[model samples]
Target: MIRIQHLSLMRGTKPLFEDADLTLNPGERIGLIGANGAGKSTLFALLRSELHADGGDVDFPSAWRVAHVAQETPALERSALDYAIDGDATLRRLQVELEEAEAHPDHAAQGHRIGELHAALADADAYTVRSRAETLLTGLGFSQQQMNRPVSSFSGGWRMRLNLAQALMCPSDLLLLDEPTNHLDLDAILWLEDWLKRYPGTLVVISHDRDFLDGVVNVIVHIDDRKLKRYSGNYSSFERQRAAQMVLTQAMIEKQTRERAHLQSFIDRFKAKATKARQAQSRMKALARMEETAPLRAAAEFSFEFREPASAPNPLLVLEAVNAGYRVEDEATGASTERTIVKHINFSLQTGQRIGLLGVNGAGKSTLIKTIATELDPLSGVARFGKGLVIGYFAQHQVEMLRHDESPLWHLAKLAPDVREQDLRNFLGSFNFPGEMATSSIAPFSGGEKARLALALIVWQRPNLLLLDEPTNHLDLETREALTDALAQFDGTLVLVSHDRHLLRATTDTFLIVADGKLMPFDGDLDDYRDWLFKTRLSPAKETQAAATANAAPSAPQVDRREQKRIEAEERQRLSTLKKPIESRIKKLEERMGKLQARKAEIDAKLAEPAIYESANKDELKTLIAEQGACGRELEEVEMAWLEQQEALEQIA
Candidate 1:
């Protein structure tokens, strides 16, 4: 268990949390939620002891093991396996001892040393460690070839997987993870959600992924206004409770206001009467003692209005085998090459239809969006916009177009041009920019703020059609919900490419899955499209060797079948006679392994202590090392036997 007491954290002059308390039980999975900069990450960092709070303490059992996965993967050159195995100090020591024993098997005291090494190894389950590492890597979508590859070769997203795999492999008592699903593709995210559901330890995760939170976590802890609120269930349940509480709060505030007004009228009408004056005074005191209602702040508001062009028509844009890609040229050599990222994507945007594009990472979702938005042309095929359909394009990289020196207000005015300065500020304020924030330069804004600014600029024009590419990237929970709500209520047609499941489910009634070298239109939600993708693109056919092996033995002839049936009956009888003995042996091995592991942990704790430095510097150190070495050897032998027995059981099946 972990407890946070009277926690107060201040960033610069702003107090993030004041007198806040939070707790986590042994097996509870908590979803840490809040608006942007509401201390979700700060609270996590404090719990992990990475950041010190202004005042208060984080309490945890001294024996508990904790692991935290940061938002960004560390820049390291280690192999993936090395990175993961380093997470467990005990396991690493065991490996070191085993490797030493293997290297010097023919030494002077070989027999005695090998015996000790075998014991220590078995206790550590060193035999299964490599297999477990491989399983975890494969489960995270990495191929066998990549397990030994240097971590630096992988992209940032894959590096995140390495970080996540490391944290998960550690057998910690508590896990602190922030945005574990941020860079993961849909399949990887789903796999993680499933893994977290079965995780044995306590979990505290700060994430904006709604689907993940709903499926994995059992509780939601919300931090707001420097106060903490705990909910008993998932994000959906939390939202329902919050909305119901808001309604009740509003009703109570209204009732209090009416009563206060009535008391004021009574005081005015009967001030001359002493009895009535005393009664009025009592009413006034009651009103004064009542705590003012803490009204919930309205979530950020977003609305897109597209200005319909009334002029010329012939479709707004057209593409005919118009190949578009960036050319890379070596200035010294004067050599250039064009790499075609996307090709033969034939699509059309009509006057009234909105299209939602779907694809895995690097599946040309952005490229398709760019082509349709007229930022790039298709390699082969015609992409034509309908007549009088003016497009307000919001690319995933639109924030890059902003000038660093220009404030958001100034940027908005420069982009829209037609809107008055006052009107532009009003529009910007809707996306949570107000007062000094509106006047702040684009360089100072966070990623989410920059995204909101880009969105505000696009909508100010109010074109007949709106194209949004990954619009919810870097947004917090509240801002994302607001953006989804706004998109759902938009009157103009919209083409969106996003991994936001909630937004896609709510806004997209149709899906265009880009797979098999083309865009295929489907009429349904993401789940339906996923099912289609699995059958068509994701799944590979069974291996020819496995298929052949499965059919190696053809169905037996009549005489062979009779003989086989007789043999099966005799085997069944023999197995029935031996079942009790086998079961008892398996149970005994498990109990013995458990006791050895307990003893191993005791020895590990003693070896890790600083007492060796103060006393028994050399001889005691060698003895402890030998004892650890013995434990490692035993652990390996026991695990190998267990694996053999398990395999035998499977073979019997």
Candidate 2:
């Protein structure tokens, strides 16, 4: 449990929280929500003790462990699995000591110490730790082979996944997760949601993903007016509750409005008269102190109609035996090799048709969408587009492609040189970029703002076909919902690739599964698609492998059924043999971890006392701190070893 009493906090003289009192009870999963820059991150900093409270106190058990994902991961030669397992501070500590003990060539003495260390490793469940880490890695979209890859090999997004896995790797009483689903696809997000629901610790997650919050969080902590308002349920419940409160408040404000107008008229008529000056002044002070309610600024509405295309063409697009993908170039040899991402995709789009693309990550959903958008030519067969076909393409990269030095006004002006400046401003205003914000450079804009600008640019052109790939990546719930509303009303043909289930469900009428290197119509809704994911796809790696085999198999196949079955059985047996030792190793590690964790708890208890820090026991305090630190290093080492075992198991699976 954690307690905050009249707490005040500031970020560079800006008060983020003032006289804020809140309580976080044991095992409560709370969703921290506010507008961006409303100090959600600052609140996390305060909890982490990186910032001191300006007033009052923040109190929690000193022995409680806190875990959060690191924002950056340095490029290193360490394998991804090892990096994740390093989150267990205790496991690493024990492993370090074990390494030293094994190195010292003292025969009987070294043997005894090594045996004792392995026992400690067993206590920590150190053996299965590797398997545990790899499970997290696999769930986050890493393959068995990728787990052994060096950290430096991955891109920024994958590294973020690594960082998240590391945080999840750590055993803690309190878990602080901020936007954990940002880089994840729909499938990964689903897996993570399930994982979080099973977590036993007190969890505080800060995310703009409303559906995710609804799925996992039980409590909503909203930061408003420099105060924390705790709501009893998830995001949807909070919305309904807030809406009801607003209605009641609005009713009272109507009566106050009448009173304010009467007082203002009285003061205006009497202030100039010398006889009424005292009374007017008294009224003025009363006006200042009156419990006034300001009108609620209506929610910023991103409401806009997509200008209908100049001409509607039947069958806007047709893919005839299309093989869509890329020709890869070998960097060193300057040799090109054709790589087919999606094979023989026979997809078509008609006027006003809406299609939602669904598949696991890297299943060529983007490839097929790109081919239809004419961004990439089909490697084989024909892609036919109707007359006057105009495409509005939205990709994840377009937001970063936005010129930081330019204003939203400038972006629109460039797209339409003939349009009047006022017209452009009006259009931008509809996107919620009003007043000075229209002219201001977007260098300081948040990701959601940049995305809106990009979408606004797309809308200005009035394309007949919309190709959106993960357009809601950084949008807040409000903006995403607004986009959903707009797209639902759009009169153009739409092909959208998004991990946001709510947006997909609301905006699309048709679904296509981009799996097995094929484009096939899915005769199901979003809920049906979820069921399909679990039933058809066992894992992301298997899905990709199956697709690759289907696309790359010989044109004339010779293998018989019995031969294939015999091969599969043999391979399964080999993997089973390979996994046995690894599983044994992980089990031993877990047992070792359990013991070390108990010992570490005892050391923490001693360190928690005030007398230990006093001059009377300074030496004892130093000795205890050192012992605690040593235990931490060993635990980390054991966890790393355990991660290797887990990676091996995933490879077999």
Candidate 3:
């Protein structure tokens, strides 16, 4: 549990939290929400002990283990699996001790130490830790081969996934995750949601994805006006509760205003009258000391609409047997090759159709979107557009192309030189860049600000077709909601590739999946897509191996029935008899290991109780500790036997 008392924090001169108090119990999953710059990150920093409260205390039990994802990972030569398993500090320590003890075989004390180290490793289930780490990598879309590769071989986004896996590997009482899904694909996001639900520890997640919050968190903590307020339920519940509270807050302000007016009136009437002077001064002091209730400030209003196109295109674009990807040519041999990512994709969009592209990280969603946007050419077939079709493409990289020295006003004017300045300014206001912000250089702007300017420039072009890929990556909750509303009202054709489930549910009418080097229509909603992903993707490694074996297996010619039956029966009987003993031993060992694990877990729960370590119960505590050690040693012996048996079984094959 954590306790915060009269906490006040300042970021430079700006007050983030003033006199805020909070209590967070163990095993609570909380979604920390606020507008950008509302101090959510600051609060997390305070808990992480990177920052100190300005006025009061933030306290937690010293025994509580805290875990958080590393913001940066330097390129390292260590294998990804080894790096992930390094998160378990206790396991690593025991492993080092065991190695040293085994090396010093002449020492009697070292022999005893080796047994203790092995027992400790067994208690942590060290033998299966690699499998657990591999599962995390797979859930985050890493191939099995990648798990064994050096961490330096992965790109930035993949490195972030490795960091997340490492954090999840650590055993902790409290876990702090900040924007965990920012670099994830839809499949990874869904996997993370399920993982968090099963995490039996306190979780504080900072995210703006509404649907994700509703699925994983049971509580919402919002930061507003330099105060922290805890809501009773999830993000949706917090929204509803905050809206009602705003209304009530405004009503209280009005009542406070009336009371102030009444007090001033009495003071004015009684002042300068000898008999009433004393009462007048008292009333004056009372009026001065009374605190005025601040009026509620409504959320900022941001709205925009796509401009009408110069010409209407009934069918915005069409793909006919298109192979979308990179085209390579060999100059020396005069040979050409096309590395097709999405092959034989055929689709067409009407003027107002809204389509959402869904797939795993490397399943070609982005490649298909780039091809549709004309950034890449089709390798084999036609990608035809309707007459007078104009495209507005917004990929994540588009924000980086803005001229650093230019402002929003300058960029819009360059697109439409003849437009009136007032109209341009008004349009910029709709994207929340008003007056001076539109005129000032955007070199120092945040990612969200740059993204808004890019969209504003696109809308000003009156594009009839739009292609967006991960447009909500850097957007805050308010901006994401604003973008969702704007897209919902868009009259032009839209094609979006995003991990945001809320935006997909609200804006897209059709779902297309780019998978297995093909683009196909998917008849389902986001929920159905999630179900499909889990069902089909849970055992990707097995499927790949099976497919490989199927392709490589030898084909036998037709033979006499008696000959085939005789050969098959002999092989079956031989393999069964050879493998039975090893298999039986493995099964018995596994059963014994399971019972030992259950007993260990029961002891762990009892050990966690504070009263178990009291003076009166010291003997009981010592006995329990000895029992736990015995169980660990037994489990270790069973695991060793099981492994040897499994090896023998594999040899029989």
By TM-score rank, best first, the candidates go 3, 2, 1
Estimate candidate 3's alpha-carbon lDDT, on a 0 to 1 scale.
0.84
lDDT of 2 at 261: 80
| TM of each candidate vs. truth | 0.71, 0.78, 0.80
Ordered by lDDT, highest first, the candidates read 3, 2, 1
Can you give the lDDT of residue 594 in candidate 3? 64
TM-score of 3: 0.80
lDDT of 2 by residue, 91-185 (tens): 99999999999888786688978999999999888999987887788788787789999999999989999999999989999999989998988
Report the candidate with higher lDDT, 1 versus 2.
2
lDDT of 2: 0.83
Please give the CA lDDT of all the candidate structures: 0.71, 0.83, 0.84
Task: Candidate 3: give its CA RMSD in angstroms.
Answer: 15.7
Candidate 1 Cα misplacement greater than 4 A, ranges: 52-57, 71-74, 80-90, 100-149, 154-158, 258-293, 296-343, 380-389, 416-420, 522-524, 530-653
- Candidate 1 vs 3: which has more TM-score: 3
At residue 409, what lDDT does model 1 achieve?
85
Model 2 RMSD in angstroms: 16.3
lDDT digits (tens) for residues 402-471 of candidate 1: 7878898888777777868888778777777888888987787887888877777776666667788877
